[model samples]
Target chain A: MTEARATMPPGAGVVMPIGGAEDKLGRMTILREVIRLAGGSAARIVVISTASSLGDEITHAYLQLFAGLGVSDVVGIRPENRDQAGDAALVATIDRATAVFMTGGNQTKLATVIVGTPVGDAIRAAHLRGAVVAGTSAGASICSEHMVSFGSGGSTPKFRVGQVSQGLGLLSGVVVDQHFTQRNRFGRLLALVAANPGQLGVGIDEDTAAIVSASGRLEVKGRGVVTIIDGADVITTAYTATGTQPLMMSGLTLHTLPRGAIFDLTTRRLVSAPGLPDETEPPKVATLADVPEDMRPRTRRIAAEGAHTTTAELRRRPASS
Target chain B: MTEARATMPPGAGVVMPIGGAEDKLGRMTILREVIRLAGGSAARIVVISTASSLGDEITHAYLQLFAGLGVSDVVGIRPENRDQAGDAALVATIDRATAVFMTGGNQTKLATVIVGTPVGDAIRAAHLRGAVVAGTSAGASICSEHMVSFGSGGSTPKFRVGQVSQGLGLLSGVVVDQHFTQRNRFGRLLALVAANPGQLGVGIDEDTAAIVSASGRLEVKGRGVVTIIDGADVITTAYTATGTQPLMMSGLTLHTLPRGAIFDLTTRRLVSAPGLPDETEPPKVATLADVPEDMRPRTRRIAAEGAHTTTAELRRRPASS
Candidate 1:
C-alpha cells in the first residue's frame, strides 16, 4: 500500500499576518501571498469571515481584490449562529469554490458557526481537491490540527502550562499561533507544545506567513520569521502527584525559519526548497525515540492478578467505620 | 458502605472577586461572603496578592481587614521575576496559610508564574488539606478543575472546533468563567459545554461567587447570579469527518442561580439555602441518567463474520489488484 504521506496531493495554503490590522500593508501582503500561492490567480474564491469582520469595508476590499485578479465569482461564509445549520449558505457556496480564505475575528465564533456544518465539509473537500485555503490571525490559528487558546504569557516555561485549547484540524498534527513575536505569545506556545508532545507548534509573526503544502512541506514567508517548535525528541518528567519529581526532557527541536525555508512534516526534517535563505548549518531536528529510555514514561505490563489485587484493596477499605 | 457524600467534609474553596476591582463595594461584599462561608470573623485569613497589587496601599487595606476581624498573617507573593520562578515565593507563602487569596493582575502572568513549581504543588496540597483558595477576575478563572486558557467567544456547538487554553484544575470536571454577565461570556460558555458534554460549565458573574462545598453543595453569594450549564444529558451524533452526524442532546440542563441558592453536585440538584433571596420557583435540575437512550452514542457489539461470499470478495479484490 502507498504511504499516507506519499498519497497527500500537492496544494497551497496561505497564512495571513493580520493580527495587527492597523497596517494595511500587512493585509495587502497577505493577499498578494495568497495570490502567489494560487498560481497568480484563482477562478473561484471562497471567503470564510467572522461576523464582526464581514462589514462593508472588508467586503469591499475583497471584492476589489477579486475584480483586480479578473476573478468573477466569490463566495462569502459568515456564520452568525453557532449551530450546525447556521452557515448553510456559506457551505453551499464553498461546495463549488476553488480557493477558500478564512478571515480574522473570534476563532471560537468561527469554529462554532462553521464546524459541523456543510461549510466545514466543503472547506475540507476543496482543500483535498488542491484548492488554496488561507486564514489570518484567528483564522490562521484554527488551521492547525491543535490550537493554542490564549493563555497567560511569560518568558518561563511554567507560564506556558495549563493553557491549551483544541483547534480545527485542517492541518492535522500541527498547532498554529498568530501575532507571534509582536504579542509575545511564546510562553503560551511552549506550554501548548509541552502539554501535547506529539504535536508541532507553529508561531507566525505579524506580516508573515507559514504556508504548508499538501505534500507536507512548510515554507516561511512575510516580513518576520516563523518559529517552529518540534517536540518529537523530548524527555520530560516532573514532580507530579501521580508519581516522580524532576521531569527530564531531551531532544526537542526548535527552528526559527525566515522567509524561504521549507520543513518536511512527515519525516520530521527540513528540506531545501525555493525561497529559503542559505544557512551556515541545517536546522536542528529531534524525535522522541532519540531520548534516553530512563527519562521516558515507563511502559508497564501487569498481570490480571495484579490488577485484581489493586482493585480488591480499594474495595476492602471500610466505608466510614 | 458509608455514602461517600455523607462522609464528605464541608468544602474548602477559594473565591475571588478581585476582577471587580472597578467596584470596590462589590469586591468587599464578596470578601465578606467568603468570610461568612469560612465560618465567621475569627477564621485565620491569608491574602495572596500579585506584585502589581501588593504595594503598600493594598497591603494596608488587607491589614485593616485582617486586623478588624482579629485574623493574623497577610503575606504578599511578590515574585521577583515576572517571567520565571519569581512567583515561587508567593506560592510558598500560600502554602502555610489556611485560606489563600490570589489577588488580581494579568491572569496569564499569574498562571505562568505559578504553574509547575513548588508553589503549584503547595497550592494543590493546601486545597487537599481543606484550605480555601479564592481568586477574582483572572484569579477566579484559574479555580476550575479544567481552567479556561482563553477560548473564542461564541454561542455555537461545533465539534472539536474552538480554541481552549489549559487552566488550573482546582475544581475539576467544571469550566469556570469570570466576568460572566458583565462580559456576556454566556455564548462562549455554552459552546464549551456543548463541545465537552461531560464537563460542567459554571459562569461566575463579577462581584459574585458560587461557593461549592466539599460535599458538592454549591451556594451562590453576592449580587449577581451564577449560570450553570450542564450538558451531561445531551445527545450528540457523529459531526466530524471521523464520526456520524446529528448529535441529539435532550437531557442537558441550564440553571441561573441568584444569591443564596444552593446546588448539590453529588445529587446534581438545587436546594434553597440561607443568604439568597427567595425565588419565585425552584430551579430545575438535570442529571446524566435523565438522558434518553437513543440520544446516547450507539455501542458497537463485536460480531463474528462467517460468509463465504464476503471472503471471496476480499480475495477477489486482492487478486485483481
Candidate 2:
C-alpha cells in the first residue's frame, strides 16, 4: 500500500469520516490524510458531526476517537434552524478555520441549505485557495462539476432524457459517480457522458478517493480505483429517439487509476510520474470534432434569409465549380 | 392559499418529508398535499430521509411521528455505499410505495447515490404511474428536467452563464432551483434560461413545493412564491463577444407563483384554474425557432448538412455569381 501524506494550505475545512466509522482504522486514516492535505494537525480540528451523526450522544464518542489520535479543538455545529441562518453560521465557521470538514450525510440537505449562501461561497473560496477539502461517500460525490441529480434506470440512453438536478460544481468539466464498480453505474455514467460528451465522467469505487488539485490534476487514493469514462470520442447521434435507441458509442476511452495514480484534467491525459504506476491500458483520447454526427444536438435555428438558388444553376454558373 | 389537492391515480407514489423537519407543520401540510395528490392516505408512502438526519435519536422521533399519523410499513434505507446498491434499495422501496418523499441533505449526495440505480428507476416508474413524489429544498430542485448545479452568484443574467451542469432530468424541459427568493438565485436561473431557451427555469422558494403532473401542470404551495423565468421568447443575438457568454435574452417572462397559483409548463401560460390563483401577465408563447437572429447559434453546419452543398460551392459560387 502506498503511504499518503497530507498537504494542507491555509484555510479551514472539516474532513469527517462520518460513514465507515466502525472501521476506526479507515476513519482515522482518512482524517489524518485530510489533516495533512489541509496542512493542519488534529489539534486544530473542529469536528461538526452534531447535525446528524451525533444524536443525543454528547459527541464524546467521536471526540474520544479523535483524542485517541492526539486530536483536539473539535466543536460541533448544531444549528437551531436547518435554514439560511444555520447555513450562515456554517460558513462563518469555515471562514474562521484553516480547514473545515463535512461529514457524509444527505448531500441534498447540505446543498439546499448551503448553496448560494455565504457558507457555500466560503467553501468554494477555500477550495480555490487550496485549502485541502475532502468528503467521503455522499460528500465525495458532490465535489464534482456536473453531479447526478437522480435519474431513471436502464442501461440504454433516452431523449429529453436524464433527471439531472443541480450540484456543487467544485470540480468543473467533470461528472462524478461514487461507488462506481460496486454499483454497476457504468450505464448511468455512460448516459450522462452521452448527454454531455464534452464533460468527463469519473466513476469512483468504494473506499477510494480521487483527490483533485487546484490546477486540474487528480490523484487516486484508497483501496479501490477511479474509473475515468471519456466520451469525447464517442460516435453516437440523436440521444433522444422514441423507439430507436441511440447508437452504442465507439472509440471512447476508459482509464482505471488505482491507488497513487495521477490524472491531468486540462489535457485529459495521465501523468506518468515516477511514484505513480500505470495499471491498465489507457483509452483513446478524443477531441471536440470527434463527437458522432448524430449525437450532436442541433443547438441552432437557421432561416434562409437570402435568395434560394437551384443546385443545377449554381453548378453550371459557378466559375469555382 | 388555494388548497387544491394533488390528483394522483391509483398505484401512484407518496412523497415524504424528512430533511426540513424544522418546518414540521409545513412539512406535514406538504405531506398531506402529496397524499391528496396521490389520492389519499391509503396510498403507500415511502419515507426517504438522510441517514444523518435520521440520527439514532431522530430516527425514533421520525418513526413515532409517522406512526402517529397512521402511516406504517415505512422502509428506511440508509445508503452505506454511494452507488447502485443504495439506489437499488431506494428504487425497491419506491416500487412498493405509491408515494415517495425525499429527505434533504446534499442534492448531489442523493443524486450520486440514486442516479442510475434501481431506486432512480423506481422513482421514474412511480412518476409515470402517477405517483405523487415530493422533494423539499434539495429534493424539490431535482424535480425539474434542467436543474441548477451551482453557479457563480449574481442577480444579473450574465452571472448565470458557465455554471450549468447535468441534472437527473426527472421533469424534462424544465430547470428547477431551490431556496429561491431567500438566496437570490434569480440571476443564475435567468442565465440558465438564456443559455437553454428550449427549457423552462423554475425557482422554488424555501418551505414551498410545486406539485407538477405528467400533463405538465404545476401548482405552487408553501410560504414563499415560486419564480418562473421563461426565456423562450428571447430576441437578442449579440449577447457576448465571442459567443462565449450566453446571448443577451430579450422578452424573457418572469412569473411569480405565490401559494395556490398554477403554471402550465407546455403552453408557457398561467391558467386561471379554480382555487389556483393567477399571479403574472400572460407572455407571448414562442417556439425555439422564434429566437432572435443574432442571439441564435449559427446553424451553418445543419444548413450545410441539409443542403448537401460543399463549402467550396458556398464561397466560390457566390463570388463568381
lDDT of each prediction vs. the true structure? 0.57, 0.54
**Model 2 chain A, poorest ten-residue lDDT window?**
A309-318
Best by lDDT: 1
> TM-score of each candidate?
0.41, 0.39
Model 1's CAPRI class is incorrect
lDDT of 1 at B293: 44
What shift in Å separates residue B133 of candidate 1 from its native position after superposition? 39
- In candidate 2, position B80 carries an lDDT of 41
Clashes of each: 42, 67
**Regions more than 4 Å wrong, model 2:** A1-321, B1-22, B50-65, B80-90, B159-162, B236-247, B273-321
What lDDT score is found at residue A280 in candidate 1? 58
